[model samples]
Target: MSATPPPTSSPELKRVVTGALVGTALEWYDFFIYGTAAALVFNRLFFTDSDPAAGTIAAFATFGVGFVVRPFGGVLFGHLGDKIGRRSTLIITTLIMGVSTGLIGLLPTHPAIGVWAPILLTLLRVCQGLGAGAEFGGAATLLAEHAPPGRRGYYASFAQTGVQIGLVLGTSAFLLVQLLPEEDFLAWGWRLPFLVSFALIGVALYVRLRVAESPVFREMERTREIVRLPIKDALARHPRNFLVGVGAHINDTAIVYTLSTFSVAYATAELGMSNHGALFGVILFALTVIVLQPVYGNLSDRVGRRPLNLFSVVFVALFVYPYFLMVDTGVPWLVWLAMMIMGAFGFAPQVAVQPVFYAELFGARVRYTGFAASRELGAALAGFSPLIGAALAARLDGAPWLVAAFLIGTAVISFVAFYASRETKDIDIADIADIDIAGIDPVRKPVAEE
Candidate 1:
């Protein structure tokens, strides 16, 4: 919002990137651990029912509960992030997420406390949701604002890289604990993963606290350009970008969960795959995503975000049927290959350009609120995907075609979104608020006196 923007230097970029990436990885570790637990252990451990099928559904319901409140969390924290500073807002969100996850470790189960166990479990999950709702939006905004324009996609993509790393760390934690005796695992091993959130909180706080606030937000503040209500403006002024942001998230959210969370369960329960084997596929998928995110991001920087966005969804759409078909084979190598392919072609490019794409979609004044609230609302909508996949499989006698069709539907939504959006790789992120949605009218003057 300042009349003149500040220059970004190479040194500052590295520091911001590290802080944002590391903090995001740690915070999302808390979130991913809960998802892995809901898939693997919570069904049996927390619920009162002995029916494995019912319990699994109940466990997944709790997982869905966390997503239910994410939009609220995004709006709340996004407002703070837009109103206050990105650095301080992110610190608070980190604390909220880490502390809630750690407490989940200490909660008693159904045998110990009956119905209270699940009720309390869902409560803690909501807290995690609130914290996570805006974590990536804030991190990406910070990194994007600090990055040089030509390489904005490359720099901001590290936040997504952190996301893959979190998934790996979370799955690795479960994989290690799975080696324990079954009795010990059900009794205590499951809690170990959640407990790690405590230590992660300390490390995350150190890094997040050191990170500087976004220069764009700081400039807005210095120029007295901060809006009284960011979320409202985001919706009222940039409705097209907001809707596109929501749709842009549908495919990745649904497909990633279908691949990572639901597939893990479906493989073990239906395909007769071992727990360890199915989880290994997840690790492979995450590693592939971790490697490809930056590659796609750097490529987006060169070729522009639109091309990658469009190509990524179409390729992923064509692969959905094969992804399920390969997983149904019951061969370890086949399953691993299947998951990796989904990660590379299905999930990577969309996520790679995602952060900077959202950053470019809205002006500085509403960036955090718009980017976070819109994306998380989409996530909340697709958050039930694993539950949907499981329910569909159960009804159709384990047939996966319905689920495949379901996934293709989400991909179509995201493809329309990507196609509808204008190119933003060349836009001035700091000055977008000055132009109206049609890009021809003056929305506001950058300087206060004007």
Candidate 2:
């Protein structure tokens, strides 16, 4: 392997990272607003015919529907991303997600339009899934491919940070709307969060359109390294890496859904907490991730991605039960503390490193497809975690132990995958596609000679 790095000037790096971050934030903002609504408003608004518990389950099922369509999104956009360019695919995805989310604001309720309300809501959610499927993988790929060597984790962390910022914005919007009179909040306030996505999409487009395509992708095309069928190439050549990516990502998705979406519904409907208290706790914890994620990502550059990933799953396994134990106490401080620890400390570190971590597993030819396909497949399973948790709790007479056990099981799956994977934090970007497993060293490599 040549001890030379890919071309990534500082000025280009800044512009690319900023574009990735802003675009990711907007896409996730649109996506998360649906999750928040499914928990707080959709059950009552769209699924009015069912009893309360059943209604919540149905609503969360719709939320999961978005995830179900993500792999297809990844397949569709990843192909375009590999064949055409990341910048263009991302532009189209932003429009799809933003327009779909905004249209959701205009959807009628069950009382007004009957079953069509939920059906239309589900269709919009699918559009969200389709766009999001390609959104993160492409953004992460763009940022990682443009980042300075030895700092991929630090730079790519910005994409995950954008995701947390989106959650914060979505939850905060709900919190603001919840302050209105209950009837009014239910009638129209729920639409505000979805409608605001139109403006966010505009800002994302402005920044994203100006940023250049990933330097690495341009290099790949120049060298004729772009494959005709990237997903097929990825699965055929790097099957182990693809499987590892799926296994390694599940805990992050499951845990986040449990805390941000499921916990809100569980707190409000089951635990008898006010919506404001539940949303406040989530918003507070999500805000901490914006700070903690980048720090952990930077740390991974020095310490290696494996140790932190292992620590994340282990932490989730040991703490999942206690996290809920704290939530059940009904003290706002205790709930917030648990959320902070679980989200900021446990989950943040895993995701902070994941974008680059997964991206590094494949060669440039199939990185986008490999990353998106594997990650979204994992997300599909974890997306229904809230509904699963609710069903488990409902079946067990409102006890959360069954749900906690399910989370621990997911952690174990991720832990084994992380344990088996080779660390790539220090691998040269040019060599990563073809680097053998035996060639990978967990310790940082010597810096390439200038």
TM-score of each: 0.97, 0.95
Question: lDDT by residue for model 1 over 34-76, one digit each (tens)?
Answer: 8888888998888757588777778888888888899899899
lDDT of every predicted structure (CA atoms) = 0.87, 0.87
Error of 1 at 127 (Å): 0.4
Backbone clashes in model 1, listed as residue pairs: none
Per-residue C-alpha lDDT of model 2 across residues 327-382, encoded as one tens digit per residue: 99888888889999998767988999998898888777777888899899989978
How many pairs of residues collide in each model? 0, 1
lDDT of 2: 0.87
lDDT for residue 260 in candidate 2, whole number 0-100: 86
What alpha-carbon RMSD in Å does predicted model 2 have with respect to the real structure? 3.0
Error of 2 at 147 (Å): 0.7
